[model samples]
Every structure is written in structure tokens, then in C-alpha cells.
Target: MLRTLTRFFVYVQTESNLKRLSLCSAARTGSAMTEPKLYRPPAEVRGMTSLDKDAFTQTITVPALRVPTGVLNKIVKSLKKSTIQRPGVPRVVQETEESSDSRLLLLDPNRVATPSSFSEAEAEALRSFGVAEELHRYELKLTYDNLKSEEVLEAVLPPGQDVTSAFSRVGHIAHMNLRDHQLPYKNLIGQVIMDKNPGVTCVVNKLNIIDSTYRNFKMEVLAGEENMVAKVKENGVTYEFDFSRVYWNPRLSTEHQRVVQLVKRGDTVFDVFAGVGPFAVPAARSGASVLANDLNPESHRWLQHNCKLNKVEGKVRTFNLDGRAFIQGPLKQELPGLLRGKASVHVVMNLPALALDFLDAFRGLLHQEPPCDHNLPTVHCYGFSKDDNPDTDVVKRASRSLGLPLEDRCSVHFVRNVAPNKDMLCVRFTLPKEVLFCSDEEHAEEPASKRQKCEDTTDSA
Candidate 1:
């Protein structure tokens, strides 16, 4: 019985495509044809380039009942011999219980049967095969005019099964229109809200069109109050971040703590890429005067706000200007007190990616008579490692240009891995007195006689 069922199913699958076409054509031409109320093609049909014909053959061949060993062998042999040899044709034969025990015999090709005549012939074949049981069967007819457009699918399940539950188990099934647009965004927003990290925040649908144009775009998270607020407790201080108007990372404050530990008391620090006072506030709290600047108007505004929030507005002076332009500007010469002989000025190049490019300007900033006091403008440089080296090579180049001995004067304090196998390093160096005064040609050409006379005078004293 199982062998007979397998043979019947193989015949159905091998001929299904031809059968569908004939059925469709018959329905279209007949007066009794009624449009299917709920039937659609599977979504896979659109993107499907090819399929395994043997898979369908194997799928239909599951045995319905045991058969004699000899009969099974004979049926399997017959199926292998009569198997369709088309490129995508099946290699095995099978049948469902409705058509079990059926055998297919080729008829004379000279006679072509009509649609009704073919149906009658199929019914007769089922009867001759001893498949006498009356069983419920459903023919799922799916069609689509344009493959790219939406598709609908229908399935007939066994009795007592919940249709919705069965469909849900088949996870790949989706509604064409609903899945295309609605589901993806819903999943994204769900992920954002479910994220465990408190530091991570997402702004959703802040930009909305009103009237004739779009304007007044802002940031809004999915959770929290009407205003965005996050409170982080670190280093015995609870810092509140207002992310409504801007976005700020608390990790920067942690980095600032590291920077402060590197600086000694009474140090004047310059924070280049100062975003919302993360570095400046912490440095100022460490008793270092901070000169913080950023190019973004909104960022500078928030930097000022954060300074006031932390009550370090007095120690930190905020500037709204381009860092490189300000460094190269005439302020160095115009304000000798602020620039020249000011050794307490520690230049912080926090932006590691682009900091190496500004080495020349930074070096120029360090150039002054007696060079800003060793206590005033100390240059703290930052750079990241690449694949070629463990330490950033740019720092070596910057040190050489400043006339500082790479090993003796410079100190590499922190090397933190920002990415896999790549590190962010902070290096501090003090400019030599000679290099700062080297621009004075008269000083450079000082005679040995004058130098010896000064030495003799120092010995006499």
C-alpha cells in the first residue's frame, strides 16, 4: 500500500505544472468558473530562481501503509525507469491517500482529451487503483498578475487545527503589504527600547513635516518623561545629562578623569573638541584652568550650560571657534601673557583621528620666547593605533618636530583599546627652551666667546 501511494504522488508532482495550466485555462473559458475568494501565490515565487526537483519527489513519497517487499521493489524499479528526464522534473513517484494504489499508463498521443474528459479520466484512474475511501481534498489555486506586487497565500489544514496558530508556526509566512513597510520600523523601535545599556539612547521621528516645509527638527527618545534625562553616578558624583536638546556621552567624563590624573595641580589645560564640558568640567574640578572650545553652535551652547550645571563655569572659559583656526590666529602674539612664556598651557588634542594633522599648528602654538612656562602650556597629544603598529607612529613625528627627545621629554601615560587591535593613546611632552627661542636668529648665532663669558660670570658668582 505504501509503495502504491508513493507511486501515485510521484505522478501528481511530475505533472502538477501542466495540470495547473490546464485547470486555469479551463476555469477561464467555462461559464461555471468562479473567481477564488481566498487564494494567492507563495512569496517565494517572486525571488525563486530554481528549485530541487528531487526534494518534492522525496516529500511526496512518505509511505501511507506497509507493502509486500516484492511489490515495493517492483514499484520502486518502475518509478526509476519511468522517471521524467526534464531538467527540473522529479525522479520519484508518490501519491496521497485520496489517490493511493493508482498506476499511470501512457495512452496513445494521437487522441487529446478535453478538460472535462481529463477530469473523468483522473476519477476513473483513482477508482481502478482501489482508492475507494471518500476523503476531504482541497485544491489551492494561487495566481498573480504582477510578480512584484503584493501576494496572498491560503492553506488548508487538517480538521480541528487552529488556522491562525498553524500559520504562526510557519514563521516565514508574511503579508506582502504589511511586512514591506510596517513591520521593519516596529522591530527597530522595539530593539531601541529594549536595549539594556542606559547610556545608549535613540531619538525617534523628531523630524516631521509641517505645513509646506520641514523645520524645527529635534530629538526624542521612546521612553522617559517628555524631556530626555539620564542620571549617571560615578566618582562619588551624580551627573544628570539632559539629552533633549543635544546628545552627550557619559563615557567622555570617565575619559576626562583619566586626563585630570595626568595633569598636575595649577596646570592650564586646553581642550580642543570640547563637547558639552565633559573634559573641561572634570579638569576644572581638578583645579586646572580649562580653555574649552568647539565649532558647533549648539555644542558650545550646551558646553556653557553644562559648565553652569557643574558650577565650574568660573574655572572653565568656553570659546566658540574653530580649534585649528584659533590655534593659528594672532592671539598668540597679541596676548603675550596668555600665549608667550605661558608654560602652564597644556594643549589637549582629544580628537585622535584628526589630531595628527594639526601637529604643526600645535607646535607653533608652543613656540614663544622661553616658551610658555613649563607649568603653563603643556601639550597632551592623542592618537590611535593602526594595523601596522602597536603604538601610534604620528606621536613620534610630532615629538621630533617639537625638538623634544622622543624618549626623555615625552611620557605615554594611557593606552586604551578603542577597537579590536587598535588603541587610543595619550602622550604628554614639554617643549625644550631652546626650540621655543630658536626663532630668534640673534640668539641662535650667539658667539662662543659670549657663551664662555656668561659661564665665567656664573662661576665667579
Candidate 2:
């Protein structure tokens, strides 16, 4: 008899009505609800072993309403907030074993564990529809198979433990930096992450820090395929690179776009340490003439490929050179001509670990003064500092590297915190004439070869 077009379901799940679990009445209007209920696994499902699906199964009784099938659709629409809204769980089920022509509309078990959750507005609406309501009891079984990944993890993870849900999605890979306490549950976490997220086939845990010459780190696969090549899109530009051989931080996408927006058509941009062209590709697409370089050959290859991939290969000139050499060689030669033109000139030093130290190479970079104050190239240099005052610290460091004071001349921008105390910052300033045009005394102190060895390089990023 419950075979009519609409199956009637009434769920009584809300904070205001949880106290009233009894037989339903036609006008059993619920109290005012303050908040919506989010689905959480029953407490009995905690401390799971190997994410056991059977362990999460539970039988629970919920308040229901028996309504005529003719008004089922209208009632379901009206009781939208009162129905079971789980991801994979259906809100409607068959009539009770009594086999009446009416359907038992089950309320959200988590909210209306008992009954009387419908609001005064709901009762008046039902009265207008001329549908009589009586709360019925229904036993429903919930299983782990239907729980969301967050709910599943929350239930199994120890109380007070740090959440491990945040991960960097690089193409199909979910890269996680697991803490010591979470290491034991890494596999379980990876499995759940891959299971819940579509198009994510692999999960990896970083084993070491990203301080290599190439800025890449070693990682152990926790789940899924071993594929390392990743295709990613940032700032509307596509890039494909070998994730293990190069450094790619999804967190820096906003920072990259921030600097690129300053470039206009006919402008010139030098991207030293440009890993896979995150800055260069988009800047070139913006009609700027770009010179992109990276010391890592893999980064260079991918930079060229990404330029072509984004159809900007013709606009970008790719180089495989050290950060300092790119500044001293191609950039030095190209700047003189571009600086004379009216278009803007910009240099992007993005290797946050070493870019600050490389600023010394810009000293005496151009043998002549810029044609005009406005024509001087602006440098966007990145650095990492753990000092309590990072803005002043970065400006001082850049000034030290350039052999001049920049405290009053340069503007420091806080980028992102790389770790607990370490912060990444970008210092922006126009190249000073004093540094670009070196005095005889300053020029004879040392050669580039000798100076490169004595600088403050690091146990850092």
C-alpha cells in the first residue's frame, strides 16, 4: 500500500525537539531550532581497527511521520531541514511492517533521536495541506560504508589529537606531512583520503625537509599508484612536472599571481629560479616579454614544456642557469635595452631559500644608470627569516646582500609562514643607482667566484 508516487518521511532532528520523543500528533509543532545538525558517527564506532566497516554499523530508533503518499513530495520539500541529509544515505524508506498505505517519513536520527522537532511553521504548512501526522518509531541501521571521510577519521582518531585532514593536492597525489603521533595511522589516513576524494589516486608522506639544491624532498608512498608526474593548474595556467624532482608549493599560487599582476604588455620580466614557470608563464600570457630560468634541469625542462603547454613558449625565453648567472648574463644584457623603453621592467626572484643571497649578483649588474627613475627595474626578492621582526629582518638582509641600506627604500611584504617560527617574505624595491654602479674600491674587493663561497648560505629552505 506504500507504493504511491511519493514516499512519506518525517525526520525530527533538531536541538529544540530532541527532548520530545513520543507519539506524533497532527499539530505536534516543534520548538524553535537554533542550529543545523552535522552528521557524526555514533560514539560506539570510535577506536576502529583498520577502518573496519562493520565496526561502525549501529541500529538506532528515530521519530517518524506517517503521511499520505499523494503529498509526499510536497512534505519532503517542506521538511527539507528535517530529513536525513547524509551523503550516501537515503532520506526515505518503505512503510512500517504494519503495512499501511501511508509511508513512515524518518527524521534524522542524530537530531530527533526521539520526536517533536518540527517547527510551528512546519505544523501550519502541514495543516494547510490537510495531512494528519502521527509520530511512528522506525529502527534504522547506519554503516561505515556510508560515512564521510571526515566523520570516519574523527571517530577513529584519538580525542585531542591534531587533525590530519589538511593535505596538498598535487594532481592525483595527496601529499601529507604527518606528525609523529599520526605516523602510526598514516596508511589509514591515506586510504580514507583517497577513498573520499575523487580523481585522487595516490597518497604520500614527506620523509624529509625540502632543503635540497633542487628544493625537492624524499617521500614515502602510503597508498595508491607510484606515479610522480603531476599536472596542475595555477592562476589559470597549466603546468605538468615531476613532483619528486622539483619543488612545487600550491600555497604560493596566490603569491605568484600577486607579482605577475604588476606586469603589463611590452614589459620585461626576469624569473630567476623560476620553477616550472608559475610566475613566468602567466606573466608572459599577460603580454610581458619573459626570461625564465632555473638551476634545476628538470625545472628548466618543465618550464619550457609549460610555456609551450600554455601557448606562451614563443613569448618566454627559457634558460638553464644558476640564479646568479641568469641575473649576471641574460638579464644583464636584456635589461639595458628594455630599461631604455617606456614599458615597465620587473625581476622576480622566487627561490625563497636562496633568492636573498643571490641579490649580491645584482650589485654593479648594470654598468650604467637607468635612463630615468621610473625606468629602473623593480625587484621582487623572496627570503625566509625566523627573526621576531621579519619585515625589518628581510629588508636588512637584502640591504646587506646588495651592500647598501634599504630600510627606508624597500617595502617588505609578509608572504606565508613556512614553519612554526620561520616566515617567508618578499622585499620590493627599485634597484639603487649606487649598487648598480660600483665604485673602484668596492669593485676590487673580490671576484664573484670567491664571494659566492663566503656568503651566509644555510641549513635552511
Poorly placed runs, candidate 2 (over 4 Å): 1-51, 96-102, 113-116, 131-133, 158-160, 368-374, 443-461
Report lDDT (CA) for all predictions: 0.42, 0.73
Backbone clashes under 3 angstroms, per model: 25, 10
Model 1 over residues 1-461: C-alpha lDDT tens digits?
55345444643443242201111112233322233212223323322323211212211111122223334444334323222222222323333455454423321111212223234544454345444323212232122321111111111112232211100000111101112222323323222222322333332333221110110124333332343444544454344544434334333445666767776666677777675666677778778877787766666887787778778889887887766665655334433465534335567776555454455553434345454443445667776554344343655756554544456567775444433334556777765554444454423221211101111100000
- In candidate 2, what residue range of length 10 has the lowest lDDT sum? 3-12
Cand. 2 Cα-lDDT: 0.73
- Writing each residue's lDDT as its tens digit, candidate 2 over 1-461 gives 23111111111121122112122222222431212222446676556546666777766566677777778888888877877665566667777566555676767644453344566777776787777656677776777667777667767778777553457788898877767877877788788888877899998888777743677777888889999999998878899999888888777878998998889988999888898989999999999999999988999999999988999989999999877789889998887777668998899998776677788887777656443455888999998876767788888888888889998898988776555455678999999877776754565333453222212221222
Candidate 1's TM-score reads: 0.45
Q: How does residue 461 of candidate 1 score in lDDT?
A: 6
Clashing pairs in 2: 9-105, 10-105, 11-107, 12-112, 13-111, 13-112, 21-115, 24-135, 30-118, 353-461
